[model samples]
Target: MTNAPLILVVEDDVQISRVLQTSLEGAGYRVAWAATLGAAIGEARSRQPDLVLLDLGLPDGDGLSLIPQLREFSVAPIVVLSARGREEDKIRALDLGADDFVAKPFSIGEVQARIRAGLRRQRQATYAEPIFRFGNLRVDLEGRSLRRNDEEIHLTPTEFKLLLTLIEHRGKAMTQRFLLNAVWGPQSLDQAQYLRVYMAQLRRKIEADPARPRYLKTETGVGYRFVPED
Candidate 1:
């Protein structure tokens, strides 16, 4: 149906692609498949999928390279399914604008959940409501203020800007360099320590338990992700 979300599966393995297509279609998503990087790009351009499931290993070229190119034309959420589980590879993919990453030998249920979450986050970004809510926390974009259970919590201008940047890309793994450049400008791209300092400051104010944050989560070596809870 035209109303169903279109999912592009860019995978070279025939069996894997078939499994994904069947599973996704059963989950109410319309599926499109591409076995190579070139065909992937062509299908993406023609179909303009609502989301993409990319495999880093492709016959023609590395699928990681397709991320930036896809970003050029579409804001559709990209969930990378790859066997390369190295920390650096994940960091590179996220830095290149991937929405999420799942390793090979992945669960069908997990992949479906990731797709649902990615699609939900994409819709949120598209609509971009001025007010964001998760549990007791609230962020008012237009008002530029944060509140917890209706109690106004003050944040410094810089801290607010940092938080705002994270909120804008909710559910995505944002690299430190990306956050730094966005908030502090390109000149401060190397100042990752600033994020550490300010993030602590933010947690102190917003988090019920600063030691274990519910919203602003660290992605180990990657960066930060703003997780929204219903």
Candidate 2:
């Protein structure tokens, strides 16, 4: 039998974590729990979970700080589970690479839906077209290599995924929410800042002039589009 998808639940609150574990397992996911940022990071590295449910207010430190470390080794989608409901808090988490954000008092059904959406996006990206090219920029999706002007351009996994998502929908204006959901997962749909930050980074690497980008065009208030040629 295939092993159920593994979900790491990182929350310091015992009751909340327990409830999450029960709910996730009931939905056919295998669950792992961590009560602190340190344990969450360590377990995430060791266990290599398929998804992470992270709580920002950990006992040891802020969970937002763990995102870069987690990104380094795993492309697993991270869904933030926090009591902090401010828009700024949500933006911060998504910008740092959290796939989705679930505030306190969330319904188990909503969380489950997010999890399913995240997993589906991950699977699609993983099995997407293996190669894409525009001008001198060449992307070998299966090989995970990118080159511009025949010179190698190294990209973080997150950046690479963003680029690929844009390429997949070339010539179409992808809204901020659609791009965020496609690349960072559904929980990040509202985090336009994340898209801005990464798009700038991508432009710097691929465009001859970052300020006057030819391929990556901004739709202003909508989102972005990728043009194969000028």
Q: In model 1, how large is the Cα lDDT of residue 142?
A: 95
RMSD of 2: 10.7
Alpha-carbon local distance difference test for all models: 0.90, 0.82
Residue-wise lDDT of candidate 1 within 1-230, one digit each (tens)? 77999999999899999999999989899999999999999999999999999999999999889999999999999999999989889888988989898988999999998899899888887789898888788889999999998689999999999988888888887888889888889999888899899999998997788899988899888888888762
lDDT at 198, model 1: 94
For residues 1-230, could you state the per-residue lDDT of candidate 2 as single tens digits?
A: 14999999988889998899988888889999999878988899889999999888888899899888899899988888888888677666665667777788899998997788678657756777677777877899789899876689999999999987776655544567778888999988778899899999999988899999999998654567676645
TM-score result, candidate 2 = 0.60
Error of 1 at 140 (Å): 1.5
Q: What is the lDDT of candidate 1?
A: 0.90
Model 1 ranges off by over 4 Å: none
Model 1: colliding residue pairs: none
